[model samples]
Target: MAEENKSCAFRTSIGGQALIEGILMRGPEQQAIVVRDQEGNLVEKVEALKFIRDRYPILGVPLIRGTVNFLDSMVNGVKALMYSADFYPDEEAAQPSKFEQWLDRKLSSKKLEGAIVTLSVILGVGLSVLLFMVLPTFITGGLLHFFPGFPMWGRNLVEGVLKILIFLLYLIFCSKQKDIYRVFQYHGAEHKTIFCYEAGLPLTVENVRIQPRHHPRCGTSFLFVVIFVSILLSSVVFGIWPITNVWLRTAAHLLLLPLVVGITYEFNRWVGRHVQDNKLAKVLTAPGLWMQNFTTNEPDDGMIEVAIRSLELVLPSEKGKDEW
Candidate 1:
């Protein structure tokens, strides 16, 4: 394979993401997108990513910086998708597929599409509030009604139990989708490529297939941290829920999201970097690793090839700056 023959030229740690009909790769210096067009030809685009850290040192601080990084990634990802969409000709665009037609009919306008996406995210948070906050509160409040004398911490205990149940069910349901399964296969491809590179193996499809699919720095792990952190943080802040209003409690949870994400980001980063030699790091990451069974599957060589090309386009030419 080309990756094996040109191993030394490739950046070792660059990673990739599977997109709707393409791949996105992020290297130290640049991010690249590659998509298969309607004509089944590969089209690629590359962009240099200059971080604010180069100019303002203070902006690079841990917690403060993650928020900006998350937001930037979201915006850039959308732009990359839009750019790739251009590869499909106007005639092809007019005869939209079921998903495209659905999106078109529902969104109607670009502004409407943006609004819908924002609303969808908000609705997701709203559902989380409904499950973790309102439903749990109701259940615990009912227990209080039954016992007529339960302590303050009892509410938090019940809420935690209910939240865990809700999270588990959500994952189970989402994992059942056919398209989601395909995406998960690509997810596995992403992890295996990173693993192959980290292990000093030549980054070929055959070599990558032998590498593990579970990645400590995965978004899956970040979510596990969010759930676990919510439990811990809520135990402190929402424990005495009998004394607080529901709206106030929900607001607190919403506000704490950035903190949770930032902390999880930092932890996952540490775990990914250290899991090679550290038993404790592996232990901490076990749940997320197990969860990958539902979120990742064996990808075919074609998918891996797309991923490899995506990674190649973004990799740094310079030494000592090859992280994905």
Candidate 2:
């Protein structure tokens, strides 16, 4: 009977990430990772989630929670990625260097993994900030130096354009990679399954395969919104206090990142809530959805099966409990 009801009504807070030959789904109470091994058998690992907010309530506050949750997502995502990668190791994974070997021997296995995952998250965040935030500011400021008469607004505009351009190019580059294409296909499957569930349809291969691959609440959308919000916020801040030096501008951009993320998170929540009924909300999410063109591809039946199973594991026992 539930399978027969296809009327779309609400969205769920549950979301997922496409991984190497796998999918990771996060729900209200837990997260699950399902991977298709070399033998074509499905294997899964599920963990009960413990929220940081549960330990520190203040971190759950709206604006503050965005940054907190982003970090939490990064950590979990990296851990899941590592786990999935372990199943499909490189053809030639180099031997650990002397220092790395020393650390491995010195630390417990769990501690070593924790250290590596923490380091990966840090490096990931660092690389993202440098490439997307700092690099744009550096280029804009460098160019503006040659034109002393360029207005602050002009400088901000250039930086914003550069940010968007770099973001687009990065996605395009990733999409072109042979390995990433499969991940993107799985990404599509994730979106499709979420859409099918939200529409009250049974999660079947036929149902999910026909669903749109792009989702407004996707991480790609949130990332784009982060850049968009930063552009708007930076324009205002840079207008107020013009910082011409590349290094100073880069520092200012870094400082504003948390605020940008917070605003984007709140905006995403609002958009996610209103997208079904509000015209403006739909418009707001269009670009991010469009960006999915590069980040998502049509998944095959097996990939859809992975998505469906991954979603099933994480779905709450109570209906409507996961409603956004």
Candidate 3:
């Protein structure tokens, strides 16, 4: 088994999300969540993954898949987060609202859980838009009113910069929170374990411990790439048409977001496949890797164990099937 593991050299498509006290790993065929419960016991749940592309083949096409995958990831991520939080509930959390109470009384437990997960995903996406999309455009619009002579291209540049700044600030603020710090540690563990696997090493805590906590394929990196691509694309679009109206510019941005995400996803995929030894790839991924310093921290051995367990449960049965 060890020798077989050592023979693989390619990166896997398998990826993970760090949870409150757990790690969630998704492979081609299965998804697993492994959490360390309040009593220090490892708890794991695994389910066969049913890809949307399987049912709707059109959705699997390259550019289209990126948007679909993004939304699917959001839903899965929110659900995983909710599951992890259940194992470590806050004693001081507010009591359920009357509407929440009514829902609880009317629905079965499983249905209620599903509703909560759906709402959480929607809210998460809404928050992301308000922060990274709507906020920066509005801020730039306000600035344009103050300086009516601001260049159209310059407006795009300012909005892009503002988006990146807001993103960085958000990550920095979250990293400082007590609970989020622990989650970041688990994030580090997830990356390290994935690195160890790609290196064809035995998935022991010690092996994972010494690996780098940054990975080229991280969603954080994808997000940075999205921001970068958006800036470039928006500048080009606005430069060609030269729109001065802020609301119109904002509307244009919303329309262009799917294209931005698709292009960024393709770029990230290229970087991930070449990053091992390609200097150009390394340079391309540098910003995201640097950002990992704020979003990921070294995990303790116990956390490493959770990450490894989560990963092991989702490993492809056929060698190289998960190749990137």
lDDT string for model 1 (1-324, tens) is 123322233324465666655778888888888777777677778888898777988867897676666666666655655565566446745776897667767765776657655665566556766765567656665566666566668666776787767766777787899867876777788777776766566679998787677776676666777778776877777654444444565677777777776777677667756665578987898887777777778888877776777767875688567743
| Tens digits of lDDT, candidate 2, 1-324 | 123223456889999999999999999988999999999999999999999898999999998999999999999999999899888988776666799889988999899989998999999999989888999988887787789999888888888999999999999999999989999999999999999899887899999888888888999999999999999998998889988888887888889999999999999999878887788998899899899999999999999999999999999989899999
Residue-level lDDT of model 3, residues 144-224, one tens digit each, is 798988888788888999999999998788879887899999999999999888888899998989888888899889988
Give the Cα lDDT of each candidate: 0.69, 0.90, 0.88
Worst 10 residues of 2 by lDDT: 1-10
* Ranked candidates, highest TM-score first: 2, 3, 1
Candidate 3, overall lDDT? 0.88
- Runs of candidate 1 exceeding 4 Å displacement: 1-13, 52-57, 80-148, 239-244
**Candidate 2 residue spans exceeding 4 A from truth:** 1-7, 94-97
How many residue pairs in model 3 have overlapping backbones?
0
The candidate maximizing TM-score is: 2
Candidate 3: misplaced stretches above 4 Å?
Answer: 1-8
Winner by TM-score between candidate 3 and candidate 1: 3
Q: Clashing pairs in model 2? A: none
